[model samples]
Target chain A: MASKLDLDPRVVRSARRLAAKAGQPVVDLARSHTTVSVERAVLRLAGVQGADQDGIPWVNRLVDAVRADVGLGHGVAVPVFHAMRSTGVDDITVLAQKAAAGAVRFDVPSSRSEVAAVKRAAKRATGGGLKIVDRRRAERERLVKRLGDPKQRPWIYLIVATGDIYEDIPQAQAAARAGADVIAVIRSTGQSLLDYVPEGATREGFAGTYATQENFRLMRAALDETSRELGRYVRLTNYASGLCMPEIAALAGMERLDMMLNDSMYGILFRDINPIRTFVDQRFSRQVHARAGIIINTGEDNYLTTADAVEAAHTVTVSQLLNEFFAHEAGLEDWQLGLGHAFEINPELPESFRLELAHALLARELFPDAPLKWMPPTKHMTGDVFRGNLLDGFFNLVGALTGQGILLVGMMTEAVVTPWLSDRDIALQNVRYVLTGAGNLHEDFAPAPGGFIQQRADEVLGEAVDLLAKIVDDSLLTAIAEGTFGIMKRPADRGKGLDGVARHDDDYYNPVTEALEA
Target chain B: MSIVRPYGDTTGDGMVQLSFTLPIPHDKRAEGAAVQLANKMGMDPALLVHARPMGDGFTFFVVYGKVSHLVDTEKVQVVERDYPLLSAKEVNATIKRRLRRRLNVVGACIGTDAHTVGIDAILNLKGIAGEKGLEYYSELSVTNMGAQVSVPDLVETARERKADAVLVSQVVTQRDAHLQNTRAMSAAFREALPAGKRPLLIVGGPRFDELMAGELGVDRIFSRGTTPREVASYLVHALVGSSS
Candidate 1:
């Protein structure tokens, strides 16, 4: 398809170039430092399992012990593995248990051969983890081939978060049967602030289910069963973000999750996670996603929720470009990029639907091969469900006309209440009607050469170029401090996880990072 | 003396529609169960208009029924606007003349509730609907603390700012979090400051019951669709005008 927006190719190129320039320093910074979560992720990859009786993860305990005694600058892998080899406790979990019990001590092995032996052991254990990830990826491919993929352009993405994994399973299966192609289990509120991932199947969570390994396994099995019954593969998604980004990514890979909310700046801007910590953790997490064949969904849609969608349009575009740069740098392919945009323009605005169409089309045209995740109207959802449903209809129509890859089914009860099962049924019916009615609309839809849609898209792209240039000049960190994106002033140095980040020493070794980079 | 009954198609018909979900599949028994439940709740001769299976072992039903219950207008009680609704100028002037200084107000969304839209609407310059927020009032200095603030931090901020009023908004009522957080906040404020020195604790949310203000240990409760001007007027009425 030709560029209906007729955006200046020169401006587009400059925006991409400036985004790359803005992200390069952050990427370099991420490469040189490691957070406590990154090291714990290594321990998790090396088969360290189970929390103590207090519900604290053994990985957190082992990493804390190592950081307390030997410091994390040398990485947790060397000291923990060295203790394993010397103590003859071959199992990392047992070693962690002993360390938590004060029976085992983490000391940096001084001798060269001892260090080399520990490195080899760490490499072997993580290599086992990699094998599992590779098998899961292959298994997903097989299932998609056998059961068949969704024969639709915009796969209906639905959310099922009942705070219990058991409850979520049935709801997710029901959604899959209701024509939803992807199911996302929203993590419990404030899970991002937790430094350690929870264990086992949790029964209680606020607003959403806990993203635990067991929960992941349970949901994956249920979705697989539903896929075979429906003859169309159902994909699973979860947040591989927050303080434990890398650890969650590693777990998602092991559990065969197909999509992850893995934005680079989302944690920094929204969650107030330290920029350095988020950057370092996101880089490693993206590498895990790349290896696991997991599509990464960036959180540019959130900026519109905090700031006005019309005014902050360029911020979303800039963040999308920067996310693209970072994901590509982390070895994620174009197809794995689920860059986000939302239909959050005030419905009362004149020509709101046309504006939404222009924005959605702009995102679609900019990243032609990427499966853009188009969000629905959230900021303007009044308690009036009648009007909310109509807004969602317009959202669905715009999605169909713009060729969005992933459309999150919007509930009319979004702001009114937690949606009932009947609400979801009605929402799915709305989506089905619009999608089937306008299935072939995109093929014939074309904006006039210099029409409103065309001019608006071009204007957003030009503004995005200017914003990216400013970000590059001030450095991304300084721009963030000045409230450039989301109108959130998150200083680079102040946030939750700055204490967990450490500069790598000369002898620092993480076999997983080494393997991923290689 | 006036009495009222729910009206659907005709006046005084006592006809009403109720929708609910039961833990049973969509079947004749499920419809019968819904009717039975409605009948137990004072609805007689209930009609099961619609039934559908929500998921496995769950059914949703819409029932139309007639109830004998009537509301007596004279005996009915509600939280009326007892205070005068002042304009922005009246509020600022009242604060200036009575308090002899600008009133300090601190607002936040305490606990793990990250939703700030409600608080922002009440505190930010660009308020919800047409009325401007408290920040637009010249004699009311507003400090909006954004979201996810802990109760202890809120108390300390209130103390530091010497706030005359602390307005807290809770949007996420999941698992009754808004109620729990409000109780915790009110209790913390009570514990930290003497009754006379304490700031007026006001909680607002869509789900909060306006009549539960005293039970929840707050000075007042603002339900949904509360304009910022109403809040400003209430502050003046409680702190400046009433005290004066």
Candidate 2:
């Protein structure tokens, strides 16, 4: 797509170059280290599942036992595989039981041939799991082709969190009927802070449903049925982030989820997951997402919630560019980059709608092929339903005018209650009214020559370039520690999950990464 | 007498001042464009009163104009607060006399909501805006579980504590996560505890609709500017004595 705005191509190039420079060190750091979660992801891919009688997952128990014994530096693959090779046991559950009973011990591989044999054996064990993921990807392609795409630009995304997976099915189906193209099962609160993914289909959760393998399967199956009925392929979304980022991504891939909220900085900034741990985990997760053909939505929108949207608009742009770089490095195409931003500028701010237009249009133009996840207003909803409804109307109008790809319908009763089904109906109606009214407004509208919209976009881009340049000089870690991104300073060495991070040893091996790369 | 109109400088004038950013530099041309855009937006005789350069290419402007619109107040309906405000003493007295025991309240910022300011203001001993939080009440046992609490864990804590009320404070309503979280909480509590044993499911946030509480499966919804006293009194009224 040609540039719609009169932005200088050179400035855009400069911003990209600076973002790449800023992200290079973090990428290098991610490559050199592996967190406990990453190692657990490897085990999960190798088909180590089921919980002990205490409901603790076998993967967590295995990883905990491994980390406790030899520590994480040697990578869990080599030790677990070596144990399997030594004991002639092919079953991960049996190995887990023996390891739990203190009957088996892990020793680092001594020779190159032994390392090769262990990796080959590990790959042999996890080959079925990789095939399952591939099968899911193939199924998604088949379904998308069978059910035609939505006849619109930004797909309406809705969320359903009934805690029980069974209850969520009907709500999700109803949302699909209400014209939502994407259904994101919001995960239970504090799930991100947990080191282990819960096992099985959980019926009870707080704030959202548990992101279990069984739950993913159930939701995917239900969504497939809905997709068939709707004749427009309905997509599934989930968070493949937090402590077990890569593990969730692997699960999401196996379930054929269409999109994943896999941000690099989200855990570090919001959930207090260690920065090094998140950075290391995010790379492996993005790799899985890229391989699964899942569009990865970055959490730059969350930054605006903590930081001022108007003042920190450039930060969102800067993070989007960085997210693009990381996604590309993980082999994701532009279309797979669902970069996130929000309509969160204080509605009371003068020209807030105009500013929102500038920001949204800028994002659309910057990553023309990327599916931008445009979030709804949440920052300044004062509970007056009348005014809130009016604000949401303007928000929908901006989304239409800017051509956002994944439009989260804004609710008039936000910041209040779990919106009733009626609230979602009204919200959907609001979106439908504006969207149907001015769906093609983008084609007819262009910023006035040298007007506020164009000027704001350029200024934000310029500032992002400057910020990226400084980040490159001072390092991304330093900037994060200084609260540059979300007004939340997270140090590299501190915070949760840092204890799980370890520098990779030469003998380390991961069959999943090897298979995906191959 | 019943009809009302927006009065700025005079009755029914509908005079308004709006500010916005233009891509052009802060110059005469940009000011003219600002006025033109304002006029296009239904502002009659729009005048650019202020213009300033934001950056190299952007300019911000404040425009003054009159809108040819009248808001008929009588035709508008709002979700007004139907309950009366009760004092803290009356609330505690009502709970003590009716329930014959202290009220147990457990509150948390469930899900990914790390912002605990809202929760803290209601549950903490420090309170907000000089109003004493639930902890300051002698008849109320408040358990503040902090941020990022899961719904299952919250329900477990509520069950263990034998809570009379479960208060959830969510500051991050981004993508309706707060609302979704509340529904999940309500559902979990409903499924986990029997109706008679179930704690009153209460949620408070800046973006919540107080009138939609029953529909969201919650016992009550508290919006922004709700004081700890308001919550305490409401708890007393709903759980202990409806006539209070």
Candidate 3:
């Protein structure tokens, strides 16, 4: 099998665990967290608070390895040496000796030095008792227990971002009543990078909307009521990838959010976030997701939004597998995987519709049982709202014919503006038509079962394996600079917002950051 | 939009690349303080933006500001399209020829992309083209997909079949997530594709420039620089020509 880059050992480890439970096909990880306050308080009590990686660059490397180790074989040492803060196991020599003896669980090489160098770096991060398995093992057990399947008949999903969490609740409730299976309160335009997660529900936001716990709790409770009233489960989602990616993941887990939009490259390609920082946050966030049993969806689909959807199709596939690899390392199961793709290729193209089918079908087969989140098209819309409506109907047909597990609703008012109720009804009517008419389409969807489709999957998998080999050889950090992932070049310390970075001092603060690193 | 959670309730993980040009000479003092202030607040120091001195003590910067956040990326609820391309004339013709009806369109910015110029170009529709506006179409129907329609309400109104199109105008590019609106509409089409068959997918805005337009997967991409003629021509050609 060909791979894109070195599979983060942590991701591999996580994938193994998820794969083990997936044999049952119905294990649910999207459970709710009832006491966010208590959990957060506990995290604070555990001395884990803000950003603690002062001077310690590449925290993502350790997080990635830890995430990969979740369900994989025996875990490896992720040396976290803090030359600044002296813990009981002060220097790298002591830490390396511990890691060698299986006392320390991590390893980090200082300035790309030798074995002793790794040891020296590892020592900087220990001293604290946070790395011990006994400290948090019981909690992990409970979080794992919350995992179970809903066995739902395709629950409907919808978005509810009004900038204000209070406003989002009413809308979310309405959507739940209207047959939405999942409700996503869109995050503020650039919420991903704010190092400090917004504390609570808010109003008056620009662009999209912000994602808040009050919003999540209010909406979750409302949906729960609706679920009982309607007899089903309603899940909530938010984003967990930015400057404080790990911190946000901790929040989501404590808050009991069912789904999170956690992608590695979203920050790199779209936000121009530092790649190393993004990956680090992703790793720790995945660990939190694993502990909280949250399902994560990647942003490979966004690449299509910028790059040509058709030409960039393979990148989507590559990203999916890489995401999968990452998720595995994070201890996430395939079912928790919500890899995204879209019906965005120009509908006018002769092969556009076929390509859509090929892509959707390929994703379904490649990662069967993953409630694949099928995205609606957004590239070619015109402000002529009516025409937008009609285009949505066509898009809906594509969703139905393809057997997409999670199909986001399409609105006609797209390019021009936000839709009103009247617009939604027409949109819903279109969806109803497709669902009722083509419900059996999947039964008829037999692309030779194992011929072209399987070959494609196999071929992609082979490519992924090959890519992984190259990454392992070249190193993951090196591959990122080469623009091998999203084909978007991202320098380690350059881009749209490098000035936002703050270097850690000898007295770097943030206890939560301290505990997690420890 | 209402706020229920208390202020600062979240840890504020979302970051913004706030860019403003100040007339300060190039200096490291202000730059250092700006980064320091953001860090003093608990935001991760990883994504700080570029803060450079413009002149005489003022400066410009693309700061990565963090705001606590929660969102699920996997579960999206939207109604939109893979692609819908049309010109003012083509859009008009699409309504007239396909459904043989007229369209009503109203457009404006809801929140703050603050780019009404985009809305004016497509909605004024005196026609950058030689043809009349989509409103003048004999067979087609149009309605603006008004900016900032509350998500819930958008769902409610988009369901109305009277309107054939919902034109939306947004110029906010502070972050790329603005595309979520288009995604919302495409999500609503699950039923339309098989039986009802919707009006048509069309979008335009300054940010929806030719290149950005394709990335958003819009049907008809009309950017700020587009002329009425070009916009109309593309819409009519795309919708009318392609469907027929």
Candidate 4:
């Protein structure tokens, strides 16, 4: 993988340095603070299951009870384990139910030995859950080895979201047989806004299926069966973002999901999750993802949906560098980084195709080892199927020529309707044709020295360097408040879930975070 | 009477191809079931062309069929473009002369619909498909509330801005959310304001049926391919020109 764009090595080093410097303060802030979702995720790992009568998760109930009784500064683990020891309730779920019912009370241990015992018990209980996560990861590796990987360079990723778990299973299997290497069950609309994860299998959803644990298990089991039949292990993906970011990440890990839509700034900018809360939750979620051997997909593709891709090309690069820094800081390997970019330039513009190649090739060349997730054209899909299909063909050509790792199939009926099965078949045909025709085109394709593609890539890289310098000076939080990335201004102190953030006290303890850090 | 039949390859052939998914696996009986369903819908000579197992117990099918149903041109009902397609100058002049003030507009995507592309295309200065949006008009003052607005907030904004027209865009129509949100919005406006004082309600989306405006309790329904010029002209026709 030679540098097709001939990017300057000196400028790349400077940009990475600036990004690491700019992201350091946010990482420090995450280390010193914790969110309700992070603690709830810890409780989930400690084997707290089920929800109350109103469908609120038991983890949420237990966390709320602990936070109310003894403020969350010391974390929920100490108070809950103390209650468990005093009541002799070995089952964490039973203790959570009793706590939610106001029948059990939690107290911070007074003696030093008592505190040590409670900490050890908390660690041991969550350790059991981690063992299960470890086993699931091992199971996935064994299956992949036996079933074999997809016989393609760029894995064909497709989405099937029928709202019902039962319905999505068949559609997902159909997609796997149709040559999709990865099947992503899109989360239900606004599931990101819900503070608690939904429990059990769900039937009614607005646009997509709910990313419940039961739904995850169901889809994983079905895909495993399909993998055995097809002899190519089909991967499953789900969103581990929004208000319940860490909880979803933990669930994805326990269910052996291969990929998670885990991004740092996506929830803060798009879903309006508080910046502080998002940062804290994303850190823990990424750690979980790293441990589960899941490739985390960052949401830099979303920036182009709102801003003009040509004008905001530098922002995508800057965000990618920042996301890379964050992912590495969380202990993720280079192979586990599915960094995202999109083909969202207005096709009517002169030389739009050339501009797309420059941007895609820039991303491809910068993070050569990372599995760059190239997204399809979305903002310009105008319901004209014939023209839309042609636009997608061009998109696939660029993906093939640039050697992207994961390609989300572009639908001709994107803006018109949820794609019918025939629409998916036609879309897959477009992908297959281009990929087969130009699969090795990248080996031969190289932009001319000082040509338009090389110059454009250089220009975007230079702008990213300047932007990173400014972000370092003004601070990333302030830059975000001024709408630096996706043109969405999200203040640190504003947005939803800000109230859920708590600064750690001197005695703060979370066994899962401790384990993950270890 | 001018009558017409569908034409696939020949004129008046009444031939069509339909695709659908069934709950049963791909088998002979499933293919027969597809034909039976098509025949029930008046495709007398239905032919199953393709059938494949979608998953464990579901099947997808493509059927070629012919029906005797004919469409009478005179009996067709549609919501034609009833207003003139005015230029930007004409629209501004008419609004200024008729109302003696700038026409105020408020737009949003209500009820968990986060897509602001449609609303932005109509209200922002950058219009879709080469036409400038309503904000380009000198005699129009626009208030774009962006995405994920609630119905109550929309009504409050409309009343506060003294809006002459309130436009809403719904892009996520899964489970008919667009229809449900439109009905709820229109009902809220009706309850909050008197008939004469309430602002004209216009709902737009890609999936909306234009003929269902009355049924959905909105004053106008703008379907796909609706440009800002059409919306501005309709505002003049309904509010300004009607009074004049």
Of candidate 3 chain B, the 10-residue stretch with the lowest lDDT total is B1-10
Give one digit per residue, the lDDT tens place, for model 1 in B5-99. Answer: 99989999999888888989888888889999999988987988988887688888889999989988989778999999999988988888888
Off by more than 4 A, model 3: A1-153, A384-387, A448-479, A482-487, A496-518, B1-170, B173-244
Better of 1 and 4 by TM-score: 1
> Per-residue CA lDDT of candidate 4, range B1-244, in tens?
4899989999889998887888897889999999999999889799999887754677888889898999999998888999888889999989888899999999999997877778877886767767888989999999887777889999999999999999999999988899999999999999999999999999999889999999999999998889999999999999889433
Count backbone overlaps in model 4. Answer: 0
Docking class of 4: acceptable
> How high is the lDDT of residue B198 in model 1?
99
lDDT string for model 3 (A1-518, tens) is 12212234454444333333321111111111111111222232232333223411122223333223331111122223332123456443343334333443432324434434434333333323233323333443443355322343344567765676777776776676666677787787556644445544577565446655455556667766666666556677888876666656765665667788898667776565765556545655775676566778788777765556665676677677667767776677777888888777766677666567667766765666677888877765666566676777777776776666676777776654454443444566677787777776766665554555445444444554556556556655556667665444566666433433333322223333334433
- The best candidate by DockQ is 1
* Runs off by more than 4 Å, candidate 2: B1-146, B149-223, B226-244
Q: For residues B151-227, what per-residue lDDT tens digits would candidate 3 score against the true structure? A: 34443455564434445565664444447766555555444443344444556665554444445544555555455
For residues A1-518, what per-residue lDDT tens digits would candidate 2 score against the true structure? 34557888899999999888889899999888988888888888888888888888888888888888898888888899999989988898889888988888888878989988888888887787778888888988898888988888789999888788998988898789878999999898778888889989888776578999899989889988888988989999999988989999989988899999998798887776788999899999998888888999899988877667898999999999999998998889999999999998977689988899999989999998998989988766767766888888888898888888898888887766656565676788789999999968778898897999999999999999999989999999999998888766788988788888999876567787787777
- What's the TM-score of every candidate structure? 0.95, 0.73, 0.52, 0.90
lDDT of 1 by residue, A149-181 (tens): 899979999998788889899889999998999
- Misplaced by over 4 Å in model 4 are B1-76, B84-105, B124-127, B130-146, B156-164, B232-244
- The A-chain TM-scores of all the candidates are 0.99, 0.98, 0.68, 0.99
Where's the lowest-lDDT run of ten residues in candidate 2 chain A?
A: A414-423
**Per-residue error at A123 for model 2, in Å?**
1.8
* Two-chain DockQ for model 2: 0.09
- Comparison by lDDT, 2 against 3, better one: 2
What docking class should model 3 receive? incorrect
TM-score of chain B of 3: 0.48
